[model samples]
Target: MHMVELKGVSKAFGDVDAVSNVDLTIREGEFVTLLGPSGSGKTTLLNLIAGMATPSAGRIEIRGRDVTHSSASERDLGMVFQNYALMPHMSVFENIAFPLRVRRLSRQEIERKVNDVLDLVQLPQIKDRKPRELSGGQQQRVALARCIVYNPALILLDEPLGALDKKLREYMQLEIRRVHAELGITMLNVTHDQDEALTMSDRIVLMNQGRIEQQDTPEQLYFRPKSVFAADFIGTANLVECEVSAVNGDRVRVTGAAGAFEVTEVEADVAVGDRVTSVIRPENVEVRAAGDDRESTGSDNPWIEAVVKDSLIVGGVVRHYLTIAGDVPVVAQQANSRSRLLLSHGDRVSLRWAQNDCRIIAC
Candidate 1:
């Protein structure tokens, strides 16, 4: 059975629609992430499924049962929020065991379950300590332990790691992935952090303006986005507007203001002669002095001449911003190494990329 299903679901506050007609299904044991910007309805969608809020229209089901009108508790699901909502006065053991006690489990059963979860969270030693005594990561784990101790059918996370620092957040990303692997639990996570979504989710549901723009595996979403928005949102993308000049199965030739180019063929909502955008990552682009001997010469290798507009060195990567076709802009990133020359502003350069690395998407 599908772990959770939403068909034609939407929610609105006054005239502002929060979630628009979203149709989605999650299979058992899948980790799905709802990702978008601040106003993009990801949190609202999570609330709809958790029964924290009712949808203005359509149905929601969990495990083949309709729960559109059910209360959050009646849905038999557990939620972890951004705040790590642990009781300040309660001991870690009591916090993890509270739900089990409410369920009327025997004393021995509660002890066993609480200990097992504490161990699972790698916090067995802190069971006697109060929530405030633990570090942020530990408290987050304790909150997670409390949610999972009762073994709910589904686990919902709403930016569970948002409160931690970058280092701790990255650590907890793997920690949560490890826990999910061990338990084989179906998880639905809501977050605006694309890096977090890309790092942990099995599939990412990209939301835009209260609507689902695309849902796909992380690699697909990054390398084969279906629209200019998806291409730009998931990561850094350089968009070149072009019109289809030729199509030959795996390769497509297009002409744009940046000049004619060839890219990998993808399913286009529009066909031949239609305008499309070519998406390429900065890392995929090769930058060198104009007419450099390293620039390949072939019908398959298309290169454009651009003048360096600006340059910045971020960590080990040198990012060069260039303008081509008069005003059209593109970015190229190169490793900061001895062999790589840093381009100065107004320096003439050639930018080239593999045809396979260029993705064509009609927008």
Candidate 2:
């Protein structure tokens, strides 16, 4: 197995600690994304693993060997940068062939490797074209092809599709996934795009201010965040302040602006009369007619009455901002074409969601 492990890795520049005591592991052939905003140390941590920078503390292991102090070349890693890093004067063929040439492979060997990689990235037809002659997506593919031409132990992509427009960027996400599957190589991607992370990763490492916030599968990170920051960052959430009324066994009653909401036991421990924030994803809140007799499907359902303030068509989903009965607003989402009700801006609505669907996040 070619899994990677970082044991308490830390990096600092002067008084600023870029990466602080971060420990992580990547299983063989798994595609993991390091996700966070700028300066969150995602890129720094990737660089440390790539051997472009040394960790101030902790050890980095590849497969089962210590590679903490190894040089970038010694690490046998394929790296693709945000800038594409193609030689301006070289054609795509020569550019992809450069890595193999560095290892002093014979001319025949270099040509074979370059041709195979170009084919793998679906850029074989453009091999003779220069970087400027190719489209943004094609150039990005060339860069990726160059990285994996030598078949490195792991591939590190640092915002490789950042320069492309939205449509092309999305197309590249799928293309990258296809390449990863074909090669069966462990991929470590650093990106700030939550959707991209959600779309492509087998697991996501959520980073914040030089520390790791949480690490889990994409579904876990999106639905069950461990902190308020994780909930807010992963997607749009309605933050509600609630006063804990009582706790009995696995049930807890919370009084809030929307009304009394009963939440089933989450992973958190709480006491009576404690103020807390409960987060509900917009997509989780169900929107129906205000007067509709919403039969209680289960004992764990939390229901609230709200009015639709506005409905927006965001991509394929309809995002509805709701004004609850008590003047507390919450955002709700519905499938753009899933509902028969013609929801408009000023329509009154009722929202219902199960207790397990809501996450009790700390404010």
Best by TM-score: 1
CA lDDT, candidate 1, residue 171: 98
Q: Which residues of candidate 2, in runs, are more than 4 Å off?
A: 295-302, 325-327, 338-340
- Model 1 over residues 155-193: C-alpha lDDT tens digits? 999999999999999999999999999999999999899
After TM-score superposition, the amount by which residue 256's alpha carbon in candidate 1 deviates from its true location, in angstroms, is 2.0
Cα error of candidate 1 at position 13, Å: 1.3
Clashes of each: 0, 0
What is the number of residue pairs that collide in model 1?
0
lDDT of 2 by residue, 1-363 (tens): 547999899999999999999989899999999999899999899999999999999999999889999998888789999999899899999999998888899999998888888888887787888899999889999999988998998999999889999999999999999999988989999999999999999999999988999999999998888888898899898878888888888887788887887787354888888888888888888777856876766574656777778778888887888887667789988777865456787787778767867767545
* 10 residues in a row with least lDDT, candidate 1: 263-272
